[model samples]
Target: MNNLLDSFSNFSYRNKNFIFLSFLILPLLWLGIVYLGSLLIFLGHSFFHLDGFTGQIVYEFSFKTLIELFSSPANIDILIRTVALAACVTIGSAIIGFPIAYYMAKFTSPKVKIFLFIAIMLPLWSSYLVRVYSWKLILAKEGIINWFFEKLNLEWLLDTILSTPVIGGPSLSISYIGMFLVFTYIWLPFMILPIQASLERVPNSLINASHDLGANKRQTFYKIILPLALPGIIAGSIFTFSLTLGDYIIPYIIGTSKFFIGQAVYTHQGTAGNIPLAAAFSLVPIVVMVVYIYIAKRMGAFNAL
Candidate 1:
């Protein structure tokens, strides 16, 4: 063992380039075979058609599925609903996470910062299903929100809100607002950590210089702090948006029977057994994310990433 270790060490030192290339090859091979290969297969399946009556997939290439997906009003509506909901979640996560992240990065002591950072990430330790179900319970008709409102004699207010159209429903658990709340809560850590990292990198000297140059707190935030933090915000948005786009579970748990892109894909592939249509539908999010990342890179978010 000793002699083998010595020989391997000598080889590593003698052929550093080969060693590094060897080290990279395994992961690259795994990525190509497992990830990209599967992706290519999935994409290839989209070009095939499924027979509705026979319920069998026809392997021959066709564009009918793609056309149907793009032209269908119901599918278009689902796409729009998902895009809008994801945008809301992204915006909401950014708004709630930024101040907390800013405080952790700029104001807290090292110990306090560590504690806060742990607290921010603590939710992730729990099972995702557990978190989603917890929100389901919390937003149910007889759940804590209703219980609290009852205690405060504000049940009537909630009743009124739930009776209104668009954002309202019979219960908070099945409303758009509830889904938004749950999504923001689930993805908050992703936003906070990135923003905190970006904030920490902004030197105290720059902040002091800004103040010395007659910039007030608000001006410093607007001109210096915000501009520097933009990249992190964009990074966080990418995670929150893409996750929301591809998520069906959260919407299924905390929302009404409305169909999002993920849910639609699941239904088409699993229940309806239309693999081609499902694959075509699934491409929407991937294409959207590609465009989104491209735009983010153009806006200089890649620097922070």
Candidate 2:
């Protein structure tokens, strides 16, 4: 027993190459078991067909589900709309986030920096559902905006928007604005922090040199700061894009319970009870993201942003 204990004690446990590799191996194993294993299970189920007559999976491989997924016009419409919405929201967030992050990096004092950071984070801790619900009330026809208009006797403002085909619509109940607003709110922090890290890495002397060389604010921002922070921006883009693609709950609560890939997967696994088909559909977005990441990396995403 003493010999065994002595042998055990001889094993040095600091993070040497072997120790690091061992740590890495444990996580790799966990990932394989949890993620890849789940995917495989889902894929395996996809081969079995759901027999309508029997109300259970038939032990048969069929292209019926895949064909239906591809051939359906409604599914195609949803995919197109989801893609467009995600793209638009991503652009909006990038435009909005860039200015905020740039200002915070270049202008803010250290004394107020932490406070500003906390202010950005404060909403994240609040209920997502409540945020959506708040928008619901705000966007309603006779809600706060209309109430304000009535109080001011500006009745014309109400008619113009409500009468407009798609500009303002009847209410905010299930508008694209709701999705865009919430998506921007939730993902803004993601965009801010990454860009801030990149901005910090840029040597202060570089910016000072540009100023010393008589470069104006626009020239410094576009030629110096933007290029240096490209990597962070790209990283932020990936986070925002992927999160928007996979989110079901946001649309479910705020929008029209619209069926994006995440909702489709959720429905398949839970309500539709077609785990296999859901798994296959889940890969569509994963594959899309992987390609996007690869393309983004090829554009020097690693070191730029």
Candidate 3:
């Protein structure tokens, strides 16, 4: 082992480019064969159609599946619903995470910071399904929330909110509001970490400089802090938005029967056995994320990464 290490070090010193290329080859091959190759195959599947009579996938090239993907009203609604929900989740995560992140970055002692960071991350150590189902119990009609409200003689407030339109439904567990809350809770950590990292990168001198220049707290935050932290905010939003867009489980477990893009893709592929439609449905998030990333890049989000 010592001889092998010495030989490798000598070889690396003598032939740096060769070693670099050698290291690059495996990953490049893996990307080509595994990632890009599979992506190409999946995208190709979207152009094919399913035979109505025999229920077999037709291998020939056709645009019928793609056309139907865009033209179908129900599919369009699902797409819109997914984007809307993802946007809401992203905003909510940002709102809830930013303050905690700011405090950790700016005010907390090292020991307190470590403790708070651990607390933020501890929830993620448990199974995602466990956390989700816990929310399920919490949001149920006879669950802790209702019980708390009942003890306070405010059960009518819960009932009233659940009866409201759009976000509300017959029960909290089956409502859009419940799903949004779960999404916000689940993705909040992703938001906080990035924002904290970004804020930490910001020098205290810059903030002090801003204050010295006669900027108020609001002005300093708006003009100095936010602009610098934009990249991290955008990065966190990318995670939250894309994750929410592709999540079927949270909607299914915590919310109503209304279909999301992820649920539609699962149903089409697993239940309906319609591979082409499933592939096409899966493309929505990919396309959306491509555009989203492009926009984020234009806004300088990639600079932080």
> Candidate 3 clashing pairs?
none
lDDT of 2 by residue, 71-188 (tens): 7887766666677777777778888888767777777899777787787677666776787677767767768876888899997976665566643444555666667877877777
**TM-scores, one per candidate:** 0.92, 0.81, 0.91
Worst 10 residues of 2 by lDDT: 7-16
Worst 10 residues of 3 by lDDT: 296-305
Candidate 3 lDDT score relative to the true structure: 0.91
lDDT of 1: 0.91
Residue range 198-274, candidate 3, lDDT tens digits: 88899999999999999999999999998888888998899999999999889878888999999999899998999
Task: Estimate every model's Cα lDDT from 0 to 1.
Answer: 0.91, 0.75, 0.91
Superposition error at 304 for model 1 (Å): 2.5
lDDT of 1 by residue, 75-162 (tens): 9999999999999999999999999989998999999999998898899666789999889889988889999999999989998988
List runs of model 1 lying over 4 Å from the truth. Answer: 1-12, 17-26
Alpha-carbon RMSD, each predicted model: 2.2, 3.4, 2.4
